[model samples]
Target: MKHLFLTALLAVAMPAWADAVDTLKRFVQEVRSGQAAFTQTVTSPDGAKKRVTQGRFEFARPGRFRFEYDKPFEQLIVADGQKVWLYDPDLHQVTVRAMDQALGATPAALLAGGSLEKDFRLAPAEASDGLQWVEAVPRDKDSQFRTVRVGFRDQALAALEILDNFGQKSVLQFSQVQSNVAVPAERFRFTPPAGADVLEQ
Candidate 1:
């Protein structure tokens, strides 16, 4: 009976792992070709939810992406397939950092060239309310976010929950994700607003 249980566990896990890898690869491939728009609703740890943020997310090969947020706050975050730029119009400040360095705590890194199996290990997760879950833990203890939990529906990423090092949790639920759409090259370009203070991270 113990052996049967173990076999059953492995049976579930192995297929899930393969599915994750394949899903990631397909997602990345589509993203690299500049396809996919992500809309997310962010909820505070206290359960208070903010207005939904809608954006057309575009990705290019090697590590480039643009997340354009429209609603409540208009902000642009772009990683030039290399360095990352986070510009906040409200604060009038732009933060720049190495793309690879910033992927430590976020799930975006999973698609940005960081190998999930290498940097973190994953396991088959639970399903509730029709959402399938996958949990990933960083191999490096010093990493910012302790764990990343991704929820999928029909192989599409439905949500992501991030648990940061400071114990702060941010939950983002996605909707209307369109894959394989053509995204323009200009979407990723950034010219800091006239007086915005640019800070390097």
Candidate 2:
């Protein structure tokens, strides 16, 4: 009877575990465009410091996306298929890098790039907080992140948690998610202000 009960328990749990992986695969393959409001919290390695920022993000697959940070400060990150742009309004600086070099094995690549299986080792993570989770570890040995976990609520993306090599953790909670919807092409395009210092990498 004990063995039978254990088998039954595993049977019930297996599909849910599979759902987490399937959900991520479906999201990557089917959801071509998405926009959302997000709250990002970054915690220090020592747990002594925390910073929170709110932002809006829009992405169209195959290497195009934009993140606009609106609260606590103004910052922007944009990728336009060819290059990635990071803009700091207060500092009047814009940093540019080739899109391929900028996104390798990063969380942005996982969400907004193609070829998921090529970049990361993905697996179902223990679900928690009413969400199914999938954890992805970069296959690249030099990736700055230790692991990236995406959480889904009812098969919709709800959260992303990233742990970096330095032990800092960042959690992004998404709201007002609109998936597979048309996002403007202009959202992914970036032009630095006239006076901003442009640095290329």
User: lDDT values of the candidates?
Assistant: 0.65, 0.86
Q: List the pairs of residues colliding in candidate 1.
A: 63-81, 64-81
Top lDDT: which candidate number?
Answer: 2
Q: Which digits, one per residue and each the tens of the lDDT, describe model 2 over residues 93-171? A: 9999999899988988888875677788877777799998888888888989999998889989999999999999999
For model 1 the TM-score comes to 0.78
Least lDDT summed over 10 consecutive residues: which range in candidate 2?
Answer: 1-10
lDDT of 1 by residue, 1-201 (tens): 000011455657665544544555465455554444555655555666544676666666566677788775798888776678999988999999887787653577764445656677666555655765667778877887777777667778666777777656666666666555566777767778898999987
Give the clash count for model 2.
Answer: 0
Stretches of candidate 1 exceeding 4 Å from the true structure = 1-9, 12-54
Give the number of the best model, judged by TM-score.
2
